[model samples]
Target: MKKKPTITAQTKQNLIDAFWELYCAKRIEKITIKEITTRAGYNRSTFYEYFTDVYDVLEQMENTLISKLKELPMQQLSSPGDPFPFEALVSMYSHHSKYLVVLLGDHGDPAFQGKVKASMKPMIKEILVSQGAKDGFELDYTLEYALSAMIGILSYWFNQEKGPSIENLMELITELSSEGVMRKLIG
Candidate 1:
């Protein structure tokens, strides 16, 4: 996204480091490009050379963080069932809670959230299909409800920094799925 050659490894690292420090301490709105540059020891022009805004910096931070967080599939997730997905999502959030709270704080943009949800949706569909779910279940309300619940739990847990452990979360997910998620679509 950088149009200028002014971007450098050191500059990128400085900006990320500055953003992380600010995000961890408080909400994203309280932080500013000026503060980031000040902390990173870079000026306005230097900051512009890399990211467009504080939000952009956070966006990139999140993109990078999610990629890193998703690297561990099983260790990072509860079972794939809807009810317990939150636990797995929450554990990953806990792994990167500071980054997430700031990235998704009140000041966070909705488009980024959409991007995140879009990425996860197909995976859910795939899980459903693989489990012998009929085509009807792919867009069924139960799936949607389950997804929303999981996302909600993830948001709450990340923001509050409180919730069940990953193991418990997985158990909950399996229990919820057994209730209906594993049922035949043809039935």
Candidate 2:
């Protein structure tokens, strides 16, 4: 008999959560399907139905995150005089901190960081232009720096045992974005 969509989705999430728990503790190569199935309380056959292997689970999770990131209200930032949506951005990131902290960590996939930067490029460019940034090498370098800094800060925040409040995090991002790091540090 066909299963309810909710059940199917929950089952998949359970497997993913189980895999994620193992993934957080050790390298992906060392995590076995048996471990995931056992943690998820599912048979091996159930895992195969949702994912081909451990790597597939990671791929799906990354795709889901990237898709959600793309869905953020980026277009709103294109309008002139509109403040950067720091609150929205932080809210989204905080919501997914569990996955992001790991995916962007030392033990995580290095290439995933690039995927995230790529997804945010267009919005970043729009924000730059709106802020009077000229289009050229400077823009390119600034974009690269901003993306790197964002990822680094996010990784740092999420990895902390007792990180700053979301409001404080948002304020920090705003300050860094508006005032150059050197200026913020010097003053």
Error of 1 at 12 (Å): 1.4
Write down the worst ten-residue block by lDDT for model 2.
178-187
Per-residue lDDT of candidate 1, residues 1-187 (tens digit): 7544455877798888998888777677899988999999989998997799888887887687657544535323434333234545665777776656655556555455555555565565566566556657445655556655555556665566467766776677666556665453213
Clash statistics: count for each candidate: 1, 0
For residue 181, model 2's alpha carbon misses the true position, in angstroms, by 8.1
- Point to the candidate with the largest TM-score: 2
Q: At residue 74, what lDDT does model 2 achieve?
A: 74
List the lowest-lDDT window of 10 residues for candidate 1: 75-84
Off by over 4 Å in 2: 77-84, 130-132, 162-165, 181-187
Q: Can you tell me which runs of candidate 1 are displaced by over 4 Å?
A: 1-7, 23-30, 66-91, 104-112, 136-141, 158-162, 180-187
lDDT of each: 0.64, 0.81
Per-residue lDDT value at 102 in model 2: 88
Alpha-carbon shift of residue 78 in model 2 (angstroms): 7.1
